[model samples]
Target: MNICVFLSAADLDERYTRPARALGELIGRGGHTLVWGGSDTGLMKVVADGAHETGGRLVGISVEFLRGFARTGADELVVATDLAERKALLLARSDAVLVLAGGLGTLDEVTEILELRKHGLHDKPVVLLNTAGFYDGLTQQLRRMEAEGFLPVPLDTLVHVADEPADALAYLERLPTAPQVR
Candidate 1:
């Protein structure tokens, strides 16, 4: 599968980078492609490096201004005109979306992804890899929204929250055949 990963572009500590690397390596070892923001720094770089070292395919979606920072050795790289275009291309080129720890840009990407899925724009499975409880608050808020009927559909129908990379991979690998309930 072409697994798209939305993650931070900023340098972070090992707490964040370790799982990101592990997830990337897993994606590669499973014969999946790593589609990402294309930045060659921070967790993006770490994950891509892990994938590349394990013989995984890399597909990077980068914007025009950030082209200089794009990964140089990706199997494929596409430069979008803007962030919107980059996001669209990232979604278009992948079969599934995996979210690792990220900052503002990552947050923006995930919200848009979920919103689109909520509206049936796509049915691609979205997994939030909650490494080290990084997304604890966000998941809590999402569940609260579902509990209060703020969401149009059940939260489980929109995305799956996985605490570990292995869990996330297992949930994703079982999809379309066995749907996740929460």
Candidate 2:
């Protein structure tokens, strides 16, 4: 499967470093393709490196302006004209989306996917890796939204949460046989 990973462009928090690395390695060893922002920095670089080390196929999508920062090891590099295009291409190509611990930019990517799913834009599985409680606040806020009747559907119908990389893969493996509730 082609897995899209949304993560911090910079490793601002140390807690996520190891998980990011492990996730990348897991993706590679599992023979999954990685679709990500075309940059070799932060958690992005760590994941890319880990995947590359295990011979995982890497497909990077980014704006032409960021070409210099692109990961040299990517098997296929695509430079979109802009961020919107990048996101669109990423979403269209990925079989599933895995969100790792990240900052504002990561939050933006996560929201983009979640909002689209909420509207029935896509049925792809969206998994959030809640490492070290990185997404605790956001998860709470989402549940709060469902509780307050602001969300038209239950939060569980929109996204899945995994505590680790292995759990995330397990969720994906279960996706096919799992009943569709949406």
For residues 20-130, write the lDDT of model 2, one tens digit per residue: 888889888888888999689989998898888886789998779888888886898899988888889999988899999887878988999999999999988899999
Candidates' TM-scores? 0.95, 0.93
Tens digit per residue, CA lDDT, model 1, 1-182:
88899999889999999999999898888888899999999999999998989878999999999999999989999999999999999999988899999989999999999999999998899999999898999999999999998999999999999998889988888876433232
lDDT of 2 at 82: 85
Pick the TM-score winner. Answer: 1
Candidate 1 worst ten-residue window by lDDT: 173-182
Q: Each prediction's Cα RMSD?
A: 3.4, 3.4
| Model 1 Cα shift for residue 54 (angstroms) | 0.6
**Alpha-carbon error at 18 in model 2, in Å?**
0.4
